[model samples]
Target: MEHEESNRSEFLVFPLSQVRKEGYKVTRKAPPSATDWSRRATRTQRGILDGSLGHYKGKAVPKGGCSAFAAQTLMKGTKPHRIRIEGMSITHDASATPDGIIDTVLSVMRYSTAVKSDSDERVKGVKGKWSSCMRKAGFQYASPQAAANDSRWSKGNVPTRLETSVAVADMQCKKKVRYLDTLVDVQSEYERNAIAEQSATLASLQSDAKVWLSNAKDEVNKQPATKRD
Candidate 1:
């Protein structure tokens, strides 16, 4: 905390009371219990570092053909089948085979742990550089994740001055070391390799899913839409 933060004054002068007032206004306009502004703000800061903020702004959500269509239609309450299980209600076409296929696909997707490990290995050098940069900036963080998850910030309704200073240093160090870009490149390479290795299995799954969806479409077309009071 000895490093002179050039912008520390700016954060200190910002009114926490104003932030609380604005948060109250925002929540009144949003659905009850739907928003957590403090957490959202912190996540946005992380997103900027990871480069996922606004990543899909101009992109269309990829449609999964009949699967996507059936999901969207059912979500809109056009689903004809309704059942209760153990006093809890759920809506899904029990006759559809997509559930089994989805479960199988999810089980196959568990290679994420390996992908993360490989990505960490590729960034070891860059991470060391980032640590050195933070040290020079007067922060003692071992990693960006450590700085972002500092326990001190959890006590405040909004980010404190020290947290803001650390976050700025974290981003600056990441930029200096090109940490995020290199991490992304490493992760994408491993992911591509994983997909290539699983190509045959994935292809078989896709083909089976298409056949099931086609049958589901015929069944859906024959059923009358459910009426609600």
Candidate 2:
């Protein structure tokens, strides 16, 4: 399963920007509720984060959501549609995608384990600063995710005033030390390093995507045309 995902990621041409961007850019700047629950939380907000708005496939899935893979894949698909829609009938113009290619352009694309490692490193670097900031603000949380899951706000209810307070405080501390900005800088630096590390593989993927898109267009053109009046 893991190998397949990495292989898929090689074909995945999406950026973190294209990967279902959250309102919060950096992990540390996120609110406590973001970790306590997801933006796609149930009314109770106890379920897992599945990247859906609780309404899916003609059902009110109060507890259900989409997988991370689906979220990443959908974001890549939507890149081509980032244009103004002028009519009810929408036609696809593939040229809108990155370089008019069918695939996405991943700068420092990594899969399963490498991605986990990168995420862990990013958090580990700034987590201490965040902890110190929280301690100064009269809180003793380890990280934002920990603050969100601190069990005080886990009674099948919405984000209460207490959660809101913590979230606000978290954001304040992060901003004070510029923790979020620093974290992004660090992550981007690592991203550049990783891209250089995997330059050969990334280059091959780019070539593959162009040919893949061209083949897709050829197959579409070969299909029979509909009869018109």
Candidate 3:
């Protein structure tokens, strides 16, 4: 599952703004107004996969050979809605091995441990400014994350009057404090330093990834395309 960008002010504003305009009521089952493509796609894929299973369809799933292949290939027919956000793009390939992607992600995450967001003194300072800004705007949240995670909003089906208000103030405060810009700068600096420190390891990982992708594509090309293709 993709992690919600609760700490970032940019991602939450649009959805919360909609809540403000529409007076959307909060419900236990309601998801956040904003969702990223990865999470959206994952949810779509999971739902479709569940339905595609034979047991779920009140029949034994087709057994053996091409039947199994077709079962696994059910998601190839799904088209998910796309959303554009700053510095983001959506990309997917059914032919790609999940293992290859998982391994590459794990390799990158291993080095990422060197730069924890909360441990950065710069982030802490900007958060302080953001807290003060929110206070001036009539909210008492410690940070954007704190405001987003406030438990009161989740306790009832009715929309809290302050949910939209707090979200608006959160976005405004982030702008006033240049929170995203400063946070990005500090994050980029730490990442660059980490890259410099792990240049050889990262390079090897990238090289391996390229080879894996090339092989995956070749394998896909070897398969016969269906009539739907």
Better of 2 and 3 by TM-score: 3
Model 1 per-residue lDDT at 141: 74
Pairs of residues clashing in candidate 2: 13-104, 50-66
Q: Which candidate is the best by TM-score?
A: 3
lDDT of 1 by residue, 4-58 (tens): 3222221121223332333212211334566675466675454443344543446
RMSD of each: 16.5, 16.9, 10.9
lDDT of 2 by residue, 3-27 (tens): 2111122222122332223211222
lDDT of 3 by residue, 35-154 (tens): 575555564344444435344345443333233344234323333222221223222244333354445444454346334655688889988999999888878987766786788666
**How accurate locally is residue 184 in candidate 3, as Cα lDDT from 0 to 100?**
70
Models 1 onward score TM values of: 0.52, 0.49, 0.54
Q: Quote the positional error of residue 33 for candidate 1 in Å.
A: 11
State the displacement of the C-alpha of residue 22, model 3, in Å, after optimal TM-score superposition. Answer: 7.3
Residue 228 lDDT (model 1): 95
Q: Regarding lDDT, does 2 or 3 come out ahead? A: 3
Model 1, C-alpha of 78: deviation from truth (Å):
25
